[model samples]
Each structure stands twice: as structure tokens, then as C-alpha cells.
Target: MHWNWQQEDWPHFAYNASALRSAEDAFLKGGGIIVGILHHVDVEARQALAIELISQEAVDSSAIEGELLDRASVQSSLARQLGLSADRRKANAAEAGAAELMADLYRSYQAPLSDKLLFDWHAMLMNGRRDLADVGRYRTHADPMQIVSGPLQAPRVHFEAPPSDRVAAEMERFIEWFNATASDAARPLPAITRAGVAHLWFETIHPFEDGNGRLGRAIAEKALAQSLKAPTLTALAETIHRHRKDYYAALHRASQDNRIDDWLAWFADIVTAAQARTTARVRFLIEKTRMLDRLRDQLNPRQEKALLRMFAEGVDGFAGGLSAQNYRTITDAAPATATRDLAGLVEMGALVRSGELRYARYHLALSN
Candidate 1:
């Protein structure tokens, strides 16, 4: 069977734009709220929010490619990149590379898309990898670039990209289309719709030997940011990673035909949901800042240290709730001191305690 790229009208994607009106409106509305919140917050709060969102995108984007990265390491790497005060923990090569790409993207979202920029992104993504015939450039191997599944002997071919000789020309067209469709362009698409189309188009090309999925998601974020004229803190990768199987299935179906109404609808829903998720995350960060401000100088040094450690775990807080033992481990306090600190935190509304004595678990009051 011929793929969508092999069709007569290849790349001339047709969709009912009017059907996505509500989704587009929601995206713009959510984007305004996020920008308003960021404007009102202090510099430190904004930096923390940037670190949280970029690190999550780095981690989740890598996860979508079957590579599991340490979220903490990614966060630390992003914090350092942002010139924020961070711990001494040095991120490994993979985590550092992903963070570098994300940090660059977040800082330079307003720049126009180009071949050099995409190559640079690919270079950052393929950092520390020894395998592959090509790095930081398009695939050059003569063999067909086909995505497959199952065992080596009986592989299921999911999709095959264009031949190697055609990649350079294909990508040039893509970059031009991308730049021409920007918000300031003569003919621009809606924010969410543009992002969705950009993602699918890039992924279909699959120019890189590796890191296509991650870079595709990055392009989608770029599309959204370009339309909004600001950096998007939306959790697009995290949302896609949540329903990874469904995401792949949707792509597979869309690859069969040029009519992508179903795909656009699915992508619009994902973008809307991602916006809602980011809205909640921004509110949680606000609450966390307030809690820290409220308890400033109220708790002892150990209590302060432990509370910050828990907050480092993001909106989920410490997993399974922070136990008294966990508190001692983080603060290196004596048993009695730990108990008093925990009690003080709960008393001051910084933590909510559950269970009794040995079984007691303390959770951040601001955890979502």
C-alpha cells in the first residue's frame, strides 16, 4: 500500500479548519492566562516555572522516544542553563544534551525556523551517541528509513520515509512552509492547528536518523510559540506521552490518507488538554511560592530544608508522601528533631499529615 507521502496530492494536506474553532479559542484563552500569571509573578517564580516546564518537556519528549531520563537531572541541567541557583548535581550527557536543546528553544522561540536551526537541534539531541551513520544532519545511508516493530525476524513495517536523495529537497520545502505560515506571515494558520500540522508534517519527513519524535514535538511547540508570540509552557510532550499508544495509532491511521480531519481533531483535543494541565501546573507553582513565602523564617533550618526538597519533586510532591524517615534522610536531623520539624510543618499548614506514628506520611499542602 502507498503511504500518504506517495500519494498524488502529497503534502497538500486538506482539513476542515472551521471544525477546530473551539479548540483554537481555548488555546488562545489559556495562553493569555499563562502570560498574565507570568507577568504578575516575580523573576524567581518565572524562572522556576520555566525550569519546571522545559525540564518536563525534555524528560517526556525523551520518554516518548523510548529513552528514560532522570527528571531531577534534567531539571538541574535546565536550572543551570537558565542561570538560576541550582544544586551541585551534574547532569549526565543525555540529560544535559536534552536540557540544552530545550533551554535553547525556550530562549529563542521567536527566531524564524531554518535548516541550520534544525541541524543544530539534531546535534544537541544526538549528543553522546556513538551509533548512527549520520549525526546533526539528514540521513545519508542508501537503505530505506523504515520504522518497524516486533522481533528482528518478523518485523512489522509501520512507515517508510522518502528516499535519502529526496530528503534535502523535502526538508527545504518544509522549512519554507513553516516560516511562511508564521503568525506574521501573509497567510497564517491558527495556533493549535498550525502546531498540529507542523508536527505531523515534520514527523512524516523523519529527516534525522534518530530523535525525530522529540524534534517533531519541539517543532509543534515552536509553532504554538510563534503564533502566541511568546514561549509556550504547554505540556505537549507530557500529554502525548500519557497516551503514547493512542498517539502512535492516530499517526498510523493519518499516514494512510491526505484527509487528516480525524488527526487534526485528535491533536486539537490533545493541545486543549495540555493547556488545561499547564494551567493547573502554573497555579500549583503559584501556591508553592505562597507557601514558601508564608513559612519564611517560621520553621527551623531543618524544616526549611526538608520542605524545599519535597517541593523539588514538582506538582506530585515526594512520592507516596514524605515519611518521617524520608524527612530525616533529607535533613540529616535526629529522630526527635525530625518529629518536631514534621509537627511544626503540619501545624503551620505547610504539610498535611496522614496515618499514625510509624505509618505516618506527610504530604506537601500545595501538592496537586
Candidate 2:
């Protein structure tokens, strides 16, 4: 028999509340701390973080659907949407469309969710695609839809969506439950916990012909935004993409058997993990800014450029930190000039020069 969560005995979906209490608490605490930390930052920092997170979310969300998009192009599209100037890379139609949809989600996640709005989002996702004929509409035929693996010659279906006749009705019920669960304290599902269940529920329904995974994540993003009452996308998509195997397993693990404790814990953990990553990134930005401010008088134009480059690239910016040749190339400075700049930075404690001549590397003087 096929597995289903739409059965009547399900979604009261019994699970040990106590099992989720700690993980749920941890996720909530982490999000609160993230929001609190973000409150003190200036508008510029917040905008930058928002752009980065939203771009990451968009790119990774598409990636989860097997549609690889250029990060630069997506950033460019998003920058145009937010009126921020970035690297100035041009975006193709798909990148522009994805970025536009992502930006819309960030901007209007506060708006009410509806069937029409979702259909619009679906069209936007396939904006430039020549492959999809159904762009925005729900599946009209009864053709069986299954998540599968292996060659088309011998495919293996991991999960099958509800039949076409049932899709519309299933969606109606899902939408009704979504509207009610958030406000009804009598419901066993807490509003916050409902986001995870919502994700599973929506994905299982798989209403649209294409873009269901991406749109389903968008639904999750909406749930998350509602819970936080914030305008930001927490970038959980990148985390999910990284651990996609476990992500799929977590969904399948929640079956008609009705135990969803593991799925709930996993969802909370992923959200908390996403928030933690954004927290660390924002903190790093703040610290980098603080450090640069303290070194304003100590750094020359070339040294400052080199520092900015490192900061922009983060971990992979410089393998063992900047080299004299790197500084020379980055600043377009002569070799002697690059050496002098490096020497000056070392003297000012902005960098530490390691190794003997010809083999030396420049590392940031920041404490490990």
C-alpha cells in the first residue's frame, strides 16, 4: 500500500511532545538571539546580510530542485531588486526570474497565502523556461507523479503524490489547516511546530506540475517568516542542500504510521542551524568592520584593498593569508612597493609576516 499522511487518523499526528521540547526550545532561543543581535546592527549591515541570506536561499533552493543557477547572476538580480549595487554581473532570464521570485518572497511573505498567489509564484519560477508548458497551473491530468531515481528505463519511485483528482481537494484541506492551525490553540500543533508539518504536508500534496519542491520550501519560508514576524529568509535552503540526503530521509521517515518526532526535531535543527550560520556571518562582518575601523589610520590604500579582498572571500580568500605577489597583483603595485606595503602592515600589527624572504606569507594579525 502507498504511504499517505492525509488519512483522517493522521495529522493529529501523534508524537511525543516531550521529545521535541528541548530541540524546539533550542531552535526558538537561537532565533531570538539572532533577531536580538540583528537589532543593534546598522541598516547597511542588515541589508547586506539580507541580500546574502536571500541570495543563498534562492540559489540553494533552486539547487535542491536540480536547477543549478549562477550565484553571481542571482546576486545581480537580487541587487537590482533591492536597489543595491553588487559585482555588476549580468543575469540571464532564469537567474533574473529566480531572483525576482526570491525577492518577492522576502518582500511579501507578510502577505496572506492563497491559491492564486501560489500559482503566481509558480509561474515566476518557470518564467524563462522553454521546457515547461504548464508554467503556473496545477496538474490537470491524472498522470501519476512520483519522486524517483535511476534511469528512465528502470525507475524506482520513492514516493508518489496524491492522485490528480485528489490534488485540488488535498490542497484545499492543507490550506484550510494552515489558516486555522496558526491561531487555534486548541490544536495539538503549535504554530511554530506547524511549519515543519506544513513543509511535509505541502510536499506530499505536490500540487503544481513543476516547482513544487521550490514552492514547498517557499511555503516553509513563509511559515518561518510568520513565526519570526520578520522579513528575512533564514537561508535554510543551503543547509538543506548540504545535507539533502538526510533531508529526504527525514520527510520519508514521517509516514502514515503518524510518528513525526524525528521529522520535527530535524526541521527545528535545520532552522536553528541556518540561524546560527547567519549569526556567525553577521558577527564576522561586524567584527571585520570594527577591526578595519581600528586600523583606518594604520592601513594605506593598497593594504586596505588587500584586507577588503580577504574579507570578501572569507575562508578561501587567502590560503595561508595574502602573499607579497598577491598583494602586488591585487593592488597593481610594483614588487618593491608590495614589499613595502606588506612591511608597513606588519609594523602596524595589521598583519604578521611569516617565513624567510621569498617564502614569506602575510597573515592577518587577528587572534586565532
Candidate 3:
């Protein structure tokens, strides 16, 4: 497919008054609910969910590192990746690693700076593990790196990275446009629309040797957060993952013709969907919190502590389910005491027992 640069007509896309207004309205409405949920969610659950959402999204966006490693491997690798001293590798290691990295990024969203800084952020994302994570710190000798889409047998190089010299200049122009357009209250485009624009512009620039897609999405996230100016509760990454094909197709269409209307519309729809999904999740969390609150009222301090630790640390001190050993570690109880605590939790409907006595794992009833 042939792609052309929209040099002269670039600002026209940015200055689309009607689209901007529509996006703005949608952003504010969606953002309000997201912010509300962010504030009310239990910190541990929220953090875990956020990590899961971001990591899954990163993996879905073609993080080969995630693809190569299973969940347990990913977790152990990520601990190694981040230089943390954790030996507990579980079934979903890659996801755990991605989640940890994503959590770090989410934390950074609390104090957002410039979109241009995305280069450094992207670099940091892939710094430790070069195998799966394509840390593109230096320029490559290869020119016009080919990006293919569609079927493998007849895959199409839909987009090409610019020559090395032009890449930096083009990226700067895109960043300038992004910062200026984002801050312009007079124009006042919606956060969702801004997200679409950021995604498109970043992909259009295609600065690095690899991982541009993930970085572009990350940049979109920053734009989304800036638009809301609140802690992000919605898993926009999940929406993107659900509509992966459409997401790529929209970028393909935009790059092919340099017309962003369709892309913006699709992005707006995804934002709306993500917000709706997050709202449901948030409501479930609230209900779970209320249930836990009631359960805590009836239990002694030890039982309450056990429950809180389980929820906070997750299904047995892991992302998924917990083991009997986890109970011992979490509660500092003897085998018999841990068994009693687990039985109590099961009785209270907070944890569901799985497997036989010797190999039982505990799962949070509220997580689903």
C-alpha cells in the first residue's frame, strides 16, 4: 500500500472543529466515572488490576518477550529484568513481569510530563531484557524497516520507518504538534480523540528499530491520562486488545490516506467501551469491598488480617490462586493453624477450595 506524508494538510486534521468537540464531550463523561472508581478502589486490588491490564495490553500489542515466555517464566524473568530479589515464579510469569512494568508506568502517570519523553520511557520499558523487549536506544543500520500486516503468506508492509536522519526530525514535529494541540483550550479536542491522534502520529513517525506499536499505545495512554488529569482506572489496554485487528486496520487506513476521521471515530468507540467495562469492574469491586467490610465486622482481628492479606497479596501470595504454604507464610501460622484459617475463609465464602487436601489452592470468590 502506498502511504503519503500529509505535510501541508496536517493541521487541517488537527483543526477539525466538529470532531474535536465530539471527542471532548465523550472524554469528559468517560473520564469522570474512571476517576471516581480510581479513588474508591482498594489500593492492592486496583494496583493488581492495573498491572494486569497494562501487561496484557503490552503483550497483545506485540511484546515478543511476553510471547516467548510463559506466565511463570515471565515473572521470574521480570524479577531478573527489574533486578528485584523475588524467587516466586508462578504459572503466569510473563504476565507478572509485564504487570510489574506496567504498574511502574501507571505510577508515572500520576505526575505526567511531556509526550516527547516517550522515547526515554519506551527505552526504559525494554532496557533490561533485549531478547523479547526491543530496547531501541541507538539507531540501526537498516533503513526503512518494514511493518507488515494481514496474512503471513501475503503479508503487506503497510508502513515503513523513515530514514534515520528524517526519523528524528519527523518525531520532533509530531511531538510539537501533539503538545501544542493537546494544551490548546481553544480547540479543546476530547481526550479520546487526542489519544487517537497520538497513536497515529507516533506510528507514523515509527522512530525505533522495533516496539513502536507498544510505545505508540503507551503514548496514547499518556494522552488519555493528561486529558483526564486523574488516576486512570479504566483498562483501555483491554479494549485495544479486544479490538486488535481493528486497531491495526485503523492505523493502516490512516497511514494509507492520511485521513484520521475513521481512526478518531474508532478510537472514541474503544475509549467508551473501555470506560463502560471499567465501570462494571469498579462496581464489582465496590460490592466486593462492602462484602469484605461486612465479613470483617464479624471476624476477629486475626481472621480480618488473613482476609486482607489474601486480597492484598492475591490468591495465595501469587497473581492467581494461593497454596497452603502461602497461608503459612502470610499468617505466620503453624500447619494446623493455617488449615483452620483456610477453613474459616472457605466457610465465610471469601475463598473457594480447589484440588484435594494436600494440593489445595485458594481462589478469591470476588475476583470473577
Model 1 CA lDDT for position 318: 73
Model 3 TM-score (2 dp): 0.67
* Local accuracy by lDDT, each model: 0.89, 0.78, 0.64
| Candidate number achieving the greatest lDDT relative to the actual structure | 1
Error of 3 at 323 (Å): 22
Q: Report the C-alpha lDDT of model 1 over 1-368, residue by residue, as the tens digit.
A: 89999999989999999999988988998899888877767887788788888899999999988999998899998888878889978788889999999988998998988888998998888888899878889989899989999999999999998988889999999999888888899778899888888898888888999999999999999999888888878899999999899999999988888899999999999998888888888888888888888888797889888888887776667778999899989999999989988998899999999999899999888645
* Structure candidate 2, residue pairs in collision: none
* Full ranking by TM-score: 1, 2, 3
lDDT of 3: 0.64
1-368 per-residue lDDT for model 3 (tens digits): 45646355643453354865765686688678666666877677665455444444555554321354353344354444444554665635335545455545566664433433565665555555546423534244455666866898998777765566676677667766666655444444557777787788777767776657767777777777767775455567667877777877777778766567777878878877877777766666665687687686666566676667765553224564778887778667889978887888889887788898888988777754
Error of 1 at 324 (Å): 4.8
| Per-model TM-score versus the true fold | 0.90, 0.87, 0.67
Clash totals for all candidate models: 0, 0, 14
TM-score, cand. 1? 0.90
Candidate order by lDDT, highest to lowest? 1, 2, 3
lDDT of 2: 0.78
User: What is the lDDT, from 0 to 100, of the residue 81 in candidate 1?
Assistant: 85
